[model samples]
Target chain A: MAEQKQVARPLSPHLQIYKPMLTMMMSITHRITGVALYGGTLLVVWWLAAAAHSDAYFAVVQGFFGHWFGKLILFGFTWALVHHALGGIRHFIWDMGRGFKLPTVEWMVRANVIGSILITVLLWLIAYGVKS
Target chain B: MNEMSNASNMKTPLKRVRGFGASKTGTEHFWQQRATAVANLPLMAVLVWFLIAHFGATRAEVIASLQNPIIALLLIMALASACWHMRLGLQVVIEDYLHSHLAKFAALALNIAIATSFFAIAAYSILKMSFAP
Candidate 1:
């Protein structure tokens, strides 16, 4: 009868050991922005709940959202939402078993990044335009 | 005696039903995630349009806009789908990173609870606004 020997194994290469590629960077950001959307959804719930409560409550919520810090947070939320949504679309395409080629993958990654920023900026521009 | 003899070699009905060993819900989870992802694409567009249209509007104005049957219904649908989708996505991330069994279980439970609570609140608020007198 042969006895099996157990030995310790080294950990897999992590962030410090591996060079970050665009795809890898975008993958991590996709996750991060996904998490950000959770917080943003909570804010949306709060705003809705306030509106349901009363005009005064809604006004308070609006006032908070109108503040500089509030606007900053909202901006981040908007960007995260757009970025994550675009990233989801990219993943969906991959799931369809296409876009595996290097060039195509790189193009998708770039699109996720740039498309998110452009859409966020455009939405915000429309928002400001509507506001005033 | 024959039944007892057969039991030793036979697979249980429950095992047969599961097809996949423990936690036989894997396919359902994956399918639901993808379904919600597809649903969110257009729903999110609607949500963005609503936000852009209503930006800087007064409380009454916002409420009135939301009070529209189509707008409120779509908003609720989007909120439910997005929150459910977000919870599942976060669950995958937490499961991958959290090594401890206890911590992973707690995190999964927390993810579902938070998502459900947020969905409930948002849905309730939307309904309230839509049906306001």
Candidate 2:
């Protein structure tokens, strides 16, 4: 029997060889924010359950959230949620067989980033405004 | 045994290719994720509007609104579907991106644990709300 030789085939373009573009960055950020959103959803459940369980439980959670660290994490969670939500919309558009063109992809990435930041800022403003 | 050997001998190596297996279940996951996202389109809108309406309300009103049986049930269903969708999407992502088997296994385990924990918490919260006075 002859020895079988392994042959190398052409590889597709991936993240390693090429410089990261905005669309690629947006795609990866969408997944990371998705993971973050999973954790954030747990926090929401905790808050809701506490509110449902008893006054004492609610008080404990509220007290913790009132702290600076909790506020910071909440802010981060808000950003992740908005970012991921817009990313989902972007993917939805792509799924509809659109947005793959160069201009549209670039514009969508810019929109996702800018829209997420804008929404997060707006949310924080409303949150703080309500607090005051 | 003789018939099985004959069948095996007649088959080509490519017949054993590992795509979707005999059950054809992979597409169900894809379908469910899309279905849930579509469902979530409306659910999310309602949820956001509800939150805004309850934004300035007292804690009592918030609890009362959540405790409503329809809303409570919807929330439970939404949470479960959302978690399921998250697991499916994240699994595809990990499979596509993560090349290291060990790292992929750990990430899969972490994703499962988080999904399970969140589901449990949401279920418990729904029960608590339903039973709350």
Candidate 3:
């Protein structure tokens, strides 16, 4: 037979082909939140280093965190941490060969998101409540 | 069951399992990732709790909190496990997306360095604060 023509074929199952699902969103968010934790971790490390040096330095650090922008970032960081933690639990359960049922998976994903938001809000509420 | 026969057979489950096969490191990596994550659950909870409890604490107040042996110990453990888990997690991310060998190598190396040194700095601060006069 003659050599086959070298025609470039379009790839099937294109990137945007699939409809979005909760499970898919959860997987993506888990990774994105995991990476975001690094920034939050660095901020905490910086805070610790400053606290070690002197009260003056620590106060300067606190001032930044007290600002509206810093507070917003910290809130997001807390949410990320909470979301990732719950997602980690979901994986941990799967690693044990359980919770593979569709219903269970869907339930866990929903809890991972809703629980993180609730817990983070509760934490900040307690923080501000105690502050007053 | 002798080694000669086993070697000749080349059908042992162990041999079948390297590369994913004989080495078995793929599953080993998976287990380690989960282990660090499990360790993080409680340690991170404690760390978060400690932070909230000390949200606006002054230097002296904070130092006193760290000075408690149990608190410092938990903080150190939290940092160590967290950073270790962070390195493992990022390694997977780097390996997945970076198609180029050079890019993967650089990112993995940087991930390890940053994660390890982050724990060092964090733990040191906790210790120095705890031990100060």
Candidate 4:
């Protein structure tokens, strides 16, 4: 490990150097969730192509989605979707010249975080609550 | 009036344009992605409601719903818009996080290929369902 150590170059100013602020946190979270969204796309494709083919195929997907690991993945997907969706709305608002004020920006970040969780939980509850 | 207008624009229009910063293309791509997302907003709601209505139904039933002209068209539109949006988002992620320039370009190309393939496959599936007897 010591022999393999490489000299590092000056790094781009990242989240570390500055005191974390609400907008910074939201920006970072947006990128993180964007990465998660890639995996979510795979899940979407699986669900679609499985349903497109046959019952057995769809059942295979349904069975996996019914399992614990699958549930966890799906939970992450849901959270990513909701979080990214809200974050995009926040960006859109900023693009339109609203929600840039200090207090509003703080509230927006807090709202995005809280709202994403609440929506994800609500979705899971409804998913389990459904009859079929 | 001539002096006032001339003074208001001291620099030639070309000079003023040249004064603007580099790579207008990036902002155009960003705006296009936002436009697609705005379109997807309503389509997404429709998809959610459609799925809920057909939830847990058999594969045949779901396919039948997809075969509906309106639903098929909407699904294709949604999938295309989504893949485009995903491609743009992932490109930025690659550019930001990937350290090696070669690796960054590779990832960007791979992301585009995957998004294109996903869209193609989805369009094929929709056509198969919609057009097949």
Best by DockQ: 3
Higher-TM-score candidate among 2 and 3?
3
- Candidate 2, DockQ to 2 decimals? 0.30
User: How do all the candidates rank in terms of DockQ, highest first?
Assistant: 3, 1, 4, 2
lDDT of the structure predicted as candidate 2: 0.75
TM-score of each: 0.88, 0.75, 0.90, 0.82
State the lDDT of candidate 3 residue by residue for B1-133, as single tens digits. Answer: 7553555576766655554644456687777888889999999999988888878778888899999999999999999998988888888899889989899899989999999899999999999999998
Q: Model 4: per-residue lDDT, tens digit, B53-112?
A: 544557777778877899988888877888898898888778768989799889989999
Give fnat (model 3): 0.60
Candidate 1 docking quality: incorrect, acceptable, medium or high: medium
Instruction: Report how far off residue A76 is in candidate 4 (Å).
Output: 1.7
- Stretches off by above 4 angstroms in model 3 are A1-5, A8-14, B1-10, B18-24
iRMS, all models: 1.0, 2.9, 0.9, 2.2
Cα-based lDDT at residue B126, candidate 3: 98
> Which window of ten consecutive residues has the lowest lDDT sum in model 1 chain A?
A1-10
Chain A superposition TM-score per model = 0.90, 0.86, 0.89, 0.83
Fraction of native Cα contacts reproduced by each candidate: 0.83, 0.35, 0.60, 0.31
Residues A28-115, candidate 4, lDDT per residue (tens digit)? 8898888787777777677777777778988898788768898788788878878888898888999999987889999999999999
Candidate 1 residue-wise lDDT at B46: 90
| Model 2 chain B worst lDDT run, 10 consecutive residues | B11-20
Candidate 2 segments exceeding 4 Å error: A1-16, A128-132, B1-23, B48-61, B97-110
